[model samples]
Target: MLKNLGTARSIFLVAGFALVMGLLGPMPAGADENCREVSLPDGSVKIICQDDGGDEGSGGPGGGGSGGGERTCEFNESEIACSSEFGVWDGRCYARVASPQPPKSTPVWEGNDDGVILECNPPGCVGGPAPCPDRSFYWSPTAPAAPGPSAEELAQRAVAAMNLTMGEIGSTPPASTSDPNAVGTIGLPIWLWIADRAENTVGPITREESDGGLTVAATGTLERTEWTLTSASGATVGAITCDGPNAAGTPYDGRNSAEPSPTCGFGADLNSSPGSLTLTGTAHWVVEWQGGGQSGQITVPPQSNSTQVRIGELQALLRN
Candidate 1:
């Protein structure tokens, strides 16, 4: 029996040793094939070399082989750690250093927590935000300044210069024939005198009061013979005797002196028929002195035979 047990035990022991050797192979050499490939949990793969040996695991090409297990990446505050070196890609950061990232672009519009829209231009790529386009809409051209004198002032000055007394006063019939009336008429003599020299003919008369001075103005034609002055003695004064251009003896067209002097002659006798003093004569005449503006004259006709002489007063008033 003992002899038989020894043979069986020898067989069993040999069989166990063969099984152990089959289960464990010898340590691989450095010269062995490197791991060719590896796969990560993220579904990415890598190649490794054979020389790294099966113990170091395998990945595709730089250290490519096969049979390495899956890898996982570990995340931390400073860096992202991985279960295996190949788990993190080349472009990714590791425990010690981080990879560079591209600059971020700014958005055109920003939103607040409440979801309201706001405008903003971020600095970076080109500099800052662009300015908004100009939006002005309306414009008006300036008006040119008005020209010349006001209408109102010109109208007033014009009305003040019109001649009316010449025709109105002289043409009126006496109040009564028996009254022996001697009413005089005043006028402007020439059209040229009125158009060019009327203002100059009359003395400078202002709106202001003068020191015991009076202004005399002539209207209508000077040749109408409408104006005269009588003395208190009941004598008739003749048409004014003017010197220079307006002189009585001098022709109407003749230019005598630079300034004209006009005088009046007196008429003789007085009528006591209806107790009226009939008088006829012209007294007032104006000549241009400083400026050659114009000249004026007042004429009177001879008294009617109904009255020998009549005394009348002469006066003048200015409008402007």
Candidate 2:
């Protein structure tokens, strides 16, 4: 049942054959057209060759079927297993990209699988998978790929570097205005100061690739904060500050309190009830990052904390 197949080169070997002992190595070199190799059910290798290259029982060329019967053939592996012998595939191993250039190779599929990818190039076709056609779906397998995964990884690192968390915010108002609860007369000014910041807890976010692994580093700083003050008294229009002041100076105007803040302060006429006025600071943190040959910045949602204040009128003494 041997047929004359053209000189095909790459060889794909299945694993089970190696485990068995009875199977012999490839047949001697001078096999005629009637010669063919077969693996018996017991894992034995045999070559049946005709005295002359004949069409005795060959279905067609290498079809290996008898009595005009047509045996089906198909490809199975999705890729060329890098370690496979240069030639057609035998459907059992993973495909790998061949390297070192100009290595043209042809694939000979041996199964009911048709997903194999084959390539042909130079130096007598000894290596590598073929290049994918243009305008097609391209997936990265250690090949030249666009900035997709790397970009995403860099973005995540930037956020962690900023480390804009709820626990990082604390107050540093003037000493006299430091009281969580304070009573001020009409026409009086309440001073404010920039809240104290916790030292650098996180660093800028960046990406690094080494030893076949990717690592992301994080570090960031706050750019600016948006603040608003709400009053419970007759004043509906509360004071808002967009200006970021470094020093806790409030003109100190004519107030008796120490270090009254002009930037981060609120003045109220009078609250009808207790604990009605509130001063809330919302910090809009901006984090910037660049690494892994890419750079970008992201803004997180506003994180805020509030302080309660009470307003009352001062009683004048009668000098009778």
Candidate 3:
């Protein structure tokens, strides 16, 4: 007896075969047609193949009719297990991209004149339990055929693969001033910046990902840094934002020691009493991607890093 298939059950059953072995390896070189490698959920591998005349003495859906006689085929509700890297689409599993290029006239590839995307269509088997696609590839112009998935989707995938981050917050006066007892003076400038600039942090870093024949590359650059200044008592006092190419801010050198920070700095009116002020710096990044004849921008979640600063009033001394 075979389970009823809601959709194209006959086609899938007629052409597909599952090894059902404990562990299977990749399809060997020069393998037979209508076969592809599949990875199972339990970290095991299996091979699914489409076979001609695979259906033998098996009852049709619900075990009603004889198997050897004329078999009826119809689409039914059935779970199609796709390979790890593939996705199910339009009642068929699709690879990331079509290998060869489908003609512009292809109904599915109508608007896309760009590049090639590979497609593997499922054929019919008489009464096979598991149905998979044939190894033969087709040209679909659009990867997985457009309107299904777009380059932007791939771009987001690349961004996720990046695992981006922001560096620690640095200050001009240093979190702990040279004179431990001498805290930052109120009404004076406090410079904030990225402590360390690296590939993953505050970076103009680039990354790329490839699948089938399609490739996408993305670059992330620091756009700005927003600062929140809070008093020791947890009261919100000031908010400073630094933007532009120097979002990371200029590290304090001996030069221009008296002037305010040219790029990213502000004067705090509040003073730290029992506890020190908390300066939290949030990094903003803009990621731009270009691939498949398209380019776009993306903004990732803000990364935050904090440092503590103590501010106090400078006492003056008068001489007789």
- How accurate locally, in lDDT, is each candidate? 0.26, 0.38, 0.58
> How do the candidates rank by lDDT, highest first?
3, 2, 1
Provide the lowest-lDDT 10-residue window in model 2. Answer: 132-141
Over 231-251, each residue of candidate 1 has an lDDT whose tens digit, in order, gives 455564333332333312211
What C-alpha RMSD separates each model from the true structure? 44.7, 20.0, 18.2
| lDDT for each residue of candidate 2 in 118-141, tens digit (9 for 90 to 100) | 232211233444342210111112
Give the per-residue lDDT of model 3 (tens digit) for 106-225: 544434566554544342322332234343343344444332234577678888877777687777556754336636667667777787778777778888865434467899888888
Better of 2 and 3 by lDDT: 3
TM-scores of all candidate predictions against the true structure? 0.17, 0.42, 0.51
Clash counts per candidate, in order, are 51, 25, 19
Task: State candidate 1's TM-score.
Answer: 0.17
Error of 1 at 94 (Å): 85
List candidate 3 stretches off by more than 4 Å. 1-150, 177-182, 268-275
Best by lDDT: 3
| Candidate 2 ranges with C-alpha deviation above 4 Å | 1-148, 166-181, 194-196, 200-219, 233-236, 242-259, 266-275
User: Once model 1 is optimally superposed onto the true structure by TM-score, how far is the C-alpha of residue 10 displaced, in angstroms?
Assistant: 99
lDDT of 2: 0.38
Q: Of 1 and 2, which scores higher on TM-score? A: 2
